[model samples]
Target chain A: GESVGLHLPTLSVQEGDNSIINCAYSNSASDYFIWYKQESGKGPQFIIDIRSNMDKRQGQRVTVLLNKTVKHLSLQIAATQPGDSAVYFCAENWSGGSNYKLTFGKGTLLTVNP
Target chain B: DVKVTQSSRYLVKRTGEKVFLECVQDMDHENMFWYRQDPGLGLRLIYFSYDVKMKEKGDIPEGYSVSREKKERFSLILESASTNQTSMYLCASSSSTDTQYFGPGTRLTVL
Candidate 1:
């Protein structure tokens, strides 16, 4: 079946350091992959997304890399700050048509120590 | 900005009781979805609607049903709330793009 998984469940990093979170997806037919940030007591917010055809995509302070060969995906956060502490989720767009139904992985909790 | 709002942030219901989880979006998006977030299971899609009065069963829709009589409002119903169904329910809305905006999840506890 189609599923998305993460390499780590929790990650701790010092402020100003870089953070890397890894994910693996089983569905090769997924058209797009997205990263979301869920703060405490809040909903998951869209951070960035990359199409399946692309190797990488970048946002303001974050980057998403996609490797189709190994079915691996990763998110990198630069200058990790206290405000960046949240549970991060990676999702795959399984429904390719007008509907964007996604399969989300078990989130990775990121804690930044100041 | 696309704003998806859920009716409740937390709910408590007894077993065998019917529960209604309501969601509304202000973006006028054509697609709305309901998902349950469990501890290690991640977010599992329960149901989704593409248009008013039209719905589709998602990955996990056995104990749940949905209604979309209005374009902006989507509701998830639990026929008989069970102990295993205690989880965070999230609602989301999306346009033609692949991105989806999520609402603050409803943490429902079934006792």
Candidate 2:
């Protein structure tokens, strides 16, 4: 079965440092990808998304990079802050063959130190 | 802003009890989804409705059912709640773009 997964379960970074979260997807037919941020006791919030046609997309302090060749995706956050500590998940969406579902990765817990 | 609201922020139910989780979206979107988030399972879709009265079973929809009688509201029903059903329920709505807007979520505990 095809699935999406994260490279790491947890990541710790300093307040001023940059943080990167990695994801690997097995489905080659997936076209759209999204990044979500979930805080404690809250639902996942949409951060940024990228289509398969493009390799990278940027929003605010966040950037999403996609590599179709390696079936890999990454989310980069610049100038990490304490408020940015949360769990991040990568989701892949396939539009082919009556498939409009989004497959989500297990997620990576990000901790920003003061 | 697209606002999706769930009926409860937290719920407690006993085993074998019937559970209902409600979600409403103010954006009048045509797509609504119900998902459960667990510790290491990420988010698993229980069900989704693309339009009024049209429902589709998701990846994990064995013990769950959905009803979408109206355009703005979608409901998830658990026939017989069990201890394994304890999880965080999330509701989301989207349009043709497929960018979902999620609600605050409801934490359910079945004891």
Candidate 3:
């Protein structure tokens, strides 16, 4: 019954603009959440992560926000560039009982236009 | 730098043939995982190993098997490759349950 899903399947953004990607998760027991970017012909790369105890975490040009009450997570990219075009995925770490596994979402395709 | 490397970037095999996909990590991680990436389905876990000689069935592990004979190396085996098995296979390693470093996935095509 544990699943993660994105609000949109495709997002088209102009270069140098900000982009916000949203995700909703079903499992409240999930303790950790991560965002990953996968470019064409490449593997998924870790962008950022936030723990259940933390509400927000920031990285270079990227921010991850976690809202435990609504079971929502979001990734914001500032000044989005052409290189930022990729499929983004949100994963949750299920730490219930003795199980430790990372479950991935369906992913969102982000296209940056010049 | 933490590095995870797969044996091949791309592979092509015929149906009913046994396929072996190898992965090795240099970070001395205790956890290694194998996942299949498909369109719209995202990354589905096929198998995982917590430590040497230990294995666990992930969300989808029907047509695949794994071997973790060493700490740094993990292998995924396809007993009889099928057309439906043609998908990108990704290998990842993590020291803890938090962050997982992924290797450039192998695009496997079963002809």
Candidate 4:
């Protein structure tokens, strides 16, 4: 999501439950969108990716939905575990041909409570 | 498997000191980028290079510089460390496809 004013949006989910995090992008020319997970001390790891030609893509226990009409994207994790707790960010790229720069979201902190 | 390694996990420097952060990628990637991640502010691109000896200033380039003398190595240099520059610095590399692989970030604190 875009920066509202000064703070980033966050979500907390209970362990063993499902969780959904949403993001809105501003680029209309972006052809690829991706989601990344980052722990407290590590860099962002790739979770999933989707192309503008596709509306939905699913990975192992994680699903990503893209709505190009509204430039919105969502990530769904089934049976969220405590290890799933981290900061999630959505990035968009226009990598159809030439060098494309990736634009990242403000990030959403997901806390999975046990 | 792709591997990206950062020279340091944590770094602290005094004000007006010159700082250098190193990054190495095992995969032969042509494009490398340097970014800073803050608590509230997401990741902001500082600099990027597509080829050795070629560099471009990203969205925010003030007070930051970058060097890419080799294909697998990219270095970020802070001319004079400042308190405002205290943040998590990340280095990333990608094939021509643009799916980036990031290294373990280096958290730089300037006093």
Interface Cα RMSD, each model? 1.2, 1.3, 1.5, 0.9
In candidate 1, how many Å is residue A47 off?
A: 0.5
Candidate lDDT scores, in order, read 0.92, 0.94, 0.94, 0.88
Per-model TM-score on C-alpha atoms: 0.94, 0.97, 0.97, 0.94
Query: For this target, which candidate reaches the highest DockQ against the unseen true structure?
Result: 1
Candidate 2 lDDT score at position A82:
97
Query: In order, how many clashes per candidate?
Result: 0, 0, 0, 0
Q: Which ten residues in a row have the lowest lDDT in candidate 2 chain B?
A: B92-101
Off by over 4 Å in 1: A94-98
Native-interface RMSD of candidate 3: 1.5
Candidate 3 chain A weakest lDDT stretch, 10 residues: A94-103
Q: Which lDDT value does model 1 have at A25?
A: 98
- What digit string (tens of lDDT, one per residue) describes model 3 on residues B1-111? 789999999999999999999999999999999999998788999999999999999989999999999999999999999999999999999986558889999999999
- TM-score top scorer: 3
Model 3 DockQ (Cα-based): 0.74
Which 10-residue span in candidate 3 chain B carries the lowest summed lDDT? B92-101
Interface RMSD of 2: 1.3
Task: Name the candidate, 3 or 4, with the larger TM-score value.
Answer: 3
lDDT tens digits, residue span A1-114, model 3: 778999999999999999999999999998889999999999899999999999999999999999999999999999999999999999998667334578899999999999
Candidate 4 segments whose C-alpha is farther than 4 A from its true place: A1-8, A96-98
Greater-DockQ candidate between 3 and 4: 4
